[model samples]
Target: MSRLLDEEGLPPGMLAPLDEDPGPARRLSRQKSAALVQAAVLAALDAPSPPPRSRRRHEWLMGGALLVVGAAAVATWHLSRRSDSLAPVETPVVAVPAVVEPVRPEPVVPAVDSERAEVAGVMRTGAEAGGDVERAEVAGVGVMRTGAEVGVARAEPDVAGVGMKQTTTGGTEVGVPRTTPDVAVPSPSAKLRGTEMLPSAPAPEDLLRRANGHRATGQWKAAEALYLRVIRTDPQAMSAYVARVASGSLRLEHLGDARGALRQYQEAQRGWPGGVLEEEASHGVTEALRALGDRDGEARALESFLARHPDSPHGVAARTRLREISGR
Candidate 1:
């Protein structure tokens, strides 16, 4: 009777059967309920109760204890399930480090034309004889006899090409033209009436006038050489750099002097830091690199230009070229 009542969550008792004659539904007295339940249990066993009727209280306690034990077991199971969900998970890690590299400046190459060095003497001799010089002059310094000497040089084959001629003497012919003493070359010029000029000024000015004339006559080599002399004596003559680049280009293109001519332009760029020629000089380098079929060098130069001069008009052109090269 106790086990059956506990399974149904009810007290361990079965009251008297329905009283059809009752005026209202009323529960049976505790003693009557206990007796009924005991009677049923005793009948099932086919024997009387082993314990006295006082043990009926113990049946209620047994049912309550079983319920408490079931509730504790359910609570413990739920707590264990919740704890599993709260456990920490392990996280994976990656080891990555940032690296920096030092940037290097562009390399510098001297514009010394060794091939031209031999031909230069030949060219100077030709110029001295007023021979054909489509392109003339070196990047740094070159010479062409100036003044009425232009026509005279044209007739003189000896001065056509480059050669070491001693300044102290008329070339290797030592002690020919008498050497002037140091005191002979005066400091400040003595004013003649309202004008004053250095004695040697006549030579350079004459050479300048002659250089322009040669340039007009398409005597680039002659013009170039004269210009170099002027700039050599006067570093402020910025035009010298531009003229050299032009002369070098023509010579290299026409004279098969690719190496020497390229050097000339390269050297000119080093000194020409400003002006229209400077812009042209940059292009000249690109052109030279292309002429040499140095695609890698040309591409690198274009890339460098874009990186350094983002705002330049050429920057867009360079970027466009790069994209084309990249096949984009």
Candidate 2:
């Protein structure tokens, strides 16, 4: 009975003897202890064992290493394919010919008919003038003559179909007919002679006369141009002096250019001091000063003019201007 109660998970002191009369409370207590012991055994049998820490960590590391190796293999394969696709391809080389330029033909110069005829006439005249004539063929078509006086004549044909004749003086002449008749040829000496015959420039007096003609015709600019040409041609001549005076008068009277007139008059005065035109230049200076509204300068110039040329035709006007400046 004690063994049975022990197997049923009962306390040793709770077991009763089998010969004693058992009550219902004792039986119910045994049944309840058996049921509690069976429940505890079932719960202990159903619980799972705890896993090992080192094995779990090792498994996770192996899986991560496999994943990394797979990714590296995939990346290496992709890079290799990309490099192959971008590789350069070789092309065949072809040889090309260099460009050649066409050559141009030289121009052909035609010979003159008049020169050819004159040369032929000269050659015929020399042959008839009673000299020993030794004839030789020149360039297969022309005749070369040797005379009593040492002379040689030569004719040659060029690529342009033109014939050339040369004459030498002891006494020989050769002529070849020209193919073209329209062209006229002049020698270098003739060109120089023509250049020497060109007309010379006009004289200063002629330029002055032209200037006077233009002035009379009311061509003021043209007249001035001619006067300037005369002055430039011969500045020290009487024509240039007259041009200065005339230019000053024109500027003063027609152009109303007091400053330009004064400049001309002053130049004339400086160029020919105390000359026959001194009275005119001095009076022109006074007039220019008056036109410019320089009363003091005009007064001084007038006094000087009167002192210099008292017997002049403009002396009365100079004295009157001086008196006006002095408030007399």
Per-model tally of clashing residue pairs: 21, 0
State each model's CA lDDT, in order.
0.42, 0.50
Q: What is the alpha-carbon lDDT for the whole of candidate 2?
A: 0.50
* RMSD of model 2 against the true structure: 63.9
What lDDT tens digits, residue by residue, belong to model 1 across residues 175-236?
Answer: 01111212122222221113332443533334545555665556756755765564454333
| Candidate that scores best on lDDT | 2
Per-residue C-alpha lDDT of model 2 across residues 62-147, encoded as one tens digit per residue: 55565566455555545555664775343111211111111111111112334335545654544334321122111122222122
Segments in model 2 whose C-alpha atoms lie over 4 Å from true places: 1-199
On a 0 to 100 scale, what is the lDDT of residue 162 in model 2?
Answer: 22
TM-score, per-candidate, Cα-based: 0.32, 0.39
> In terms of TM-score, which candidate is strongest?
2
Pairing residues by index, what is the TM-score of model 2? 0.39
